[model samples]
Target: MKKVTVYLSENTYDVLNNLSSKRKESMSLIARKILEKGLTEEAAKDGIDAVTDAVRRAMRDILKPTEDRLAKLAAKAAVAAATAMYLNTQCIADLGKNNALELYQIARTKAVAYLREKDEEA
Candidate 1:
């Protein structure tokens, strides 16, 4: 096997020294075994993390089209509701001499407030 030089902190060296004496093994052998085991565990953990990320990406990809479709449908529904509301308000509410533009703005403001109130309730 190839040789490698590594710097160890005083505490780490002391721990290794104690283990070597207790196990009757060389400090170099103990350090090597520990390093190998740590590397193996880290590699397995990294593999699991990689798989989890891939699954998350796959789920997002699968759900994206459905999300887009629902958003489009909701937008269409909102437009239809706004048009119907405007028509109903024009027929029922007294416009006096106020232009249709003013009425539209007023309706828009009311609609926004109503939506905000509903959102807060939810």
Candidate 2:
């Protein structure tokens, strides 16, 4: 074991001295026990933090591919929706106003149903 020196405030020293006399132990022994207990608690806390960090890192690693896949799926959905909208506009232009409105309602219903099915699957 290595020797270490530490300074204590007057109140702290007095408390330790009182405890030492009451316990019939030297102040050095009491201080040593206190220091050991404190160091042990600190080490345990550090160990817990390290484990928590490792678990977090592992979770992030595990989720990264899923996150990327979801991002790609979202991008694809956006592009597909944009394309469908453009096509719908063109079709409405070609068809008459009344016919276009009816067709739009049908398309909207189908799109809503499709979205519901996808949401359920998710």
RMSD to the hidden true structure, all candidates: 3.9, 4.4
The candidate that wins on TM-score is 2
Model 1 bad stretches (over 4 Å): 94-122
1-122 in candidate 2: lDDT tens per residue?
89889999999999999999999999999999999999999999999999999999999999999999999999999999889887887778686665776677788899888877845546
Per-residue accuracy of model 1 over 75-107 as CA lDDT, tens digit each: 999899989887866765564645766677787
- Residue 41 in candidate 1, Cα distance off native in Å: 2.0
Which portions of model 2 show Cα errors greater than 4 Å?
Answer: 98-122
Can you give the lDDT of residue 85 in candidate 2?
A: 82
lDDT of 1 at 117: 80
lDDT of 1 at 3: 98
Instruction: Judge candidate 1 against the unseen true structure and give its global Cα lDDT, from 0 to 1.
Output: 0.89
Give each model's whole-structure lDDT.
0.89, 0.91
Q: Cα deviation of 66 in candidate 1 (Å)?
A: 0.7
Task: For model 2, state the Cα shift of residue 86 in Å.
Answer: 1.7
Model 2 local distance difference test score: 0.91
Global fold similarity of model 2 (TM-score): 0.73
